[model samples]
Target: MSKMIKPWIKLIALIIALPILSYISLRVGVIPVGHTDVLALGSDASSQAMIALNDNRIPRTVVALLVGSVLGLAGLLFQLVTRNPLASPDILAVNAGASLAIVLVTLFGFSSIASFTSAALVGAFIAGVIVYLLSANGGNVMYMTLAGASLAALFSSFTQSIIAYEEGALDEVLFWLTGSVAGRSLALVTTLLPWMIVASLCVLLISKELETLSLGDQVARSLGQNVGVIKFVAVTLAVVLSAFGVALAGPIAFVGLLAPHLARYMFGTAFFARLAGSALLGSVLLLSADIFGRLVLFPREVTVGVVLAVIGGAFFIYLVSARQGVFKS
Candidate 1:
């Protein structure tokens, strides 16, 4: 009973903390706002605060929550598919594909949030297939890791070259490249939310099958599962979610890789529970990071990606050193 109740307790605690953090996110920004005055009645001083809260802070917070949730889900799915704890859209080239597509669009003078998102979908699919094919030899984890790392480097170079050629747009592209939720709006959320919802629904539908697959191919097949179909669908869902995240906030690394592991430790091996825990934990991590980024430099803001990269890079090294190439199996 104690063991069974612990997971629920952890999950509930996470769920409760999410909204509190979100509210705090709205309240805490470079421009301090009078929360009570803004909420109760509008005054001259409160007007500017309201504008910032409604236009900038709220939208940014929502995007962070949505993107974080999808990335968390995608990370868990990727881990199950690759049977690798370190697997993530950024690490596995899915975000690279999306970033490449968006960079190309921006370079061509035909860039919009919607276009970047659609292009990212195509790129993610293509990149995922390439990674799978390269690593398809008995699903060797090492080959997939090496191939993903190589492609990520190649795609990043392509992105950098394009940005360098378009010197005038370099700053704008650089911001997006660094991964941020700044300047995003509710409209961006409205545009991308459908894709996120569909992808999330797909994850829900495959939850049970994913649990089986995690047990191993032989067990899944013995239990009458179609391994190929399940793997394909699962991978597709992961790419979609990853693409949405990249489109929303350039390639925020480690949210996916870190979220799932955190969830597993808290929620045990139950698929749906782990997914929920991951999403909630991811939201907290990202929102907190964004909040931290806002204050870390005072009037100057740091991108959440850079912040996570510093943290995640350290964590990644620790993972490799500790695991020695073999993660939790």
Candidate 2:
């Protein structure tokens, strides 16, 4: 218990600091809306700034935080189930499923949020089922990863072909594929909030079962746990949460891959501790990236996904090289 205190404190500090950083970054864009302008909301310039802050920056920031946290939670769940740190939504074809669904919808000229959400959910579930079947054959993690990667590659290829044939869909698909919070509306945040909340509750409910399952299937079964049921529930929740995130924010990567590992590094692999810590860390990681994007380019903004990809790619290489045996069970 005493050993856990430091990580919790760090997590708290990150949670508190994220909003402050987001606030500052919100004002630092090329439009030149300062903190004072946000506060005032009186002068004409201030009024426009307020509108931009509320209508643009606020929604994007909120989406980043929510999507990041969701991906982190989903990744943690996947890793625990597979007992592999490399198992993440993106790695396992969950994001690919959602992206394919959205691309199909976009190609058909169906841009409604509801349609996007439904398609993504279906796609993610189907992809997860396929991966599960492939992995469960021999209970082999390597097989699962390979199968997922193949499925993701196939789906991504299909998506690219669709984009190639339809010039009108290029801009929308490109932005989504790269992952961006730019031009996101408040309605997207609203549409995604309830799904996130429900899925989060489900994740919390399964935390104890996940901890037990981590002890091995024989131990879990001996302890009266329904291993199959628990796996289904956890995977379902992860897929749903990840689908909604991809639908709302596009296929943002690495938040899911990195957040849980960071949490474990800080919290020593305890289940609840890693869960909570990763949630906070994920939020901070994403918000910080979004803030950096705002500051670095100023008026012409870059996507948070672009920033994370570069950082995450380098970090992944370092992790794989330094900790080759970390995931061995």
Candidate 3:
């Protein structure tokens, strides 16, 4: 009975908490979003609350949900591929690659979301390739994580240099670097929705292969899986999803790092269940962080990225010190 009840507990808790958190997200902004205003949509209603709800809060929440889900899913895939618990865009420079590309495009006077997103995808793919090749040489999770962290630092230095010299781009650069979903428009969501959908479908299609591959290369090969192709596909999908996340939320830290581990901790390691749990946990973490950001400093809210960094950084330290076996597993 206890064993049977355990599997469904986290799912049921998530289902219950989602609507509640979402309600707080919709209502707890600088400008309160009333239930009446929400219900009044599509009718003859003209109020600041309505505009705030429809234009600002709702879109922000959606982007948070989308970005979080993508990061969580990408992290799960990456960890599976590397057999490394610490593998994630935040730690592995995947987000840094996308961030650098977006910064470059913006500096070149290209401000369109589509252009930024395309550049991000290319940059993320390049980063993924470099990390994989270098890590392949070492053939261990620690070496791979260190390689990724080094690359992330290098990319971040480049990003900061660009922002330093180009004073005019500072404001825009800082906003993205800080990483918030606030003040984003629905147009951003619409622009990235198709790519997100396409990536998700790709995940679903390759999930079986992923499950088999998770069992170790020797086992998977014995099971007739093409190891190289599976790794390539999984890595590519992870990069695409990471790019989408960075494009949406400006390299928000550690959703990828934290979400999958939390999901696996809570739900156990069934491949599909872990994936779904990761997505759900990611959404909760980001949305809750955003809400906390809004309320913590009152009028001067911290960026969601800052909130995540504080939380994730601490969590990361705990993993390193307390759960060192995370890498071995």
Candidate 4:
């Protein structure tokens, strides 16, 4: 009975938590929006509060969910494809490439989302190709990670250089680099939702292929999977998803790295189960963090990236210490 009910239990728990967290997120800001009071929402007292809720809080929360889900799925894909638990969008330099592109666009005084998103997508694609080429020599995950790290560092340096030289754009660069959701609008949400939905569906549809590929290239090949094509498609989809998230939310860290493993720890090795669970978990983590940030500072909200970086940094260290065996290979 316990065995039979376990999956349902996990699903139910997540289902219960997601809405509750989202509700609490909606209510607990610097200016309180009561769960039951729609009167204030109609009055002049609620004008600024309404604007904050509808424009800033709601969109940021939604973006958190989308960004978290994208990172989780992308991380899962990269890990599966490389058979490396540590492989993620950031590790592949996709985030760095997208970030670099965005920084370049901003440096040139281009603030349009369309321009930034397109540039980021292109940059991410290029980074993925480079990582693929560098790793193809002997399928060495270490070499690939090293090459990606080098590229990330290089791009990061370039981004820093731009911020240093462009005094006028310093504030914009800093805000973007730190990953804020402070002044997001519903229009931004409208612009990015379709892409997130399509990308998520693509990830879901490719889960079986990913599962097959996990068994090893020889096994996947013997099973009639076009190993190369499947890997390419999966990686490309993952990169696009990551790039979109970066363009929208800046380069959020560790949701990708942390979510899939947390899902695996909870749900075992089933790819679809892990994928869905990770998406939910990622959303919960990011939204919860964002909410916590708001409450912690009261009137002054902290950036989501700053909160995640501190948490992710500690979590990453713990993961490294505990999972040395996995990386030793």
Note the Cα lDDT for every prediction shown: 0.84, 0.81, 0.86, 0.80
Per-prediction CA RMSD (Å): 2.3, 2.4, 1.9, 2.4
Q: In candidate 4, where is summed lDDT lowest over 10 consecutive residues?
A: 37-46
- How many backbone clashes does every candidate have? 0, 0, 0, 0
lDDT of 2 at 214: 91
Point to the candidate with the largest TM-score. Answer: 3
Encode model 4's per-residue lDDT on 1-329: one tens digit a residue.
33354765786798688878877777877776766543354444546668667766677878887788888888888888888777888878889889988888777878787888888898888888888788888767678778877887888898888888886766866776777656555676688789888988988898898889989999999999999999988888889988988887888887888888888888886567787887788888888888878877888888777888888889877877887776566
Among residues 3 or more apart in sequence or in different chains, the pairs in candidate 4 whose N, CA or C atoms overlap within 3 Å are none
**Candidate 3 C-alpha lDDT tens digits along 1-329:** 33465666667787687778877888887887787776776675668898788788888888888898899889998988888888998788899989998898888989888898898999898888788788887578887888899999999999999999996866776787778887776787899998887897788688789989988999999999999999988888899999998888898999999999998877675567677788788889999999999999998888899999999999989888897786674
Residue pairs with backbone overlap in model 3: none
Q: State the displacement of the C-alpha of residue 248, model 1, in Å, after optimal TM-score superposition.
A: 0.8
Task: Please give each candidate's TM-score.
Answer: 0.93, 0.92, 0.94, 0.92
Flag regions of model 3 displaced more than 4 Å. 6-9, 326-329
Over 140-236, each residue of candidate 2 has an lDDT whose tens digit, in order, gives 7668778888988988898888888886766767777888766777786897898799898888877899889999988999999999999889888
**What's the residue-level lDDT of 38 in candidate 2?**
64
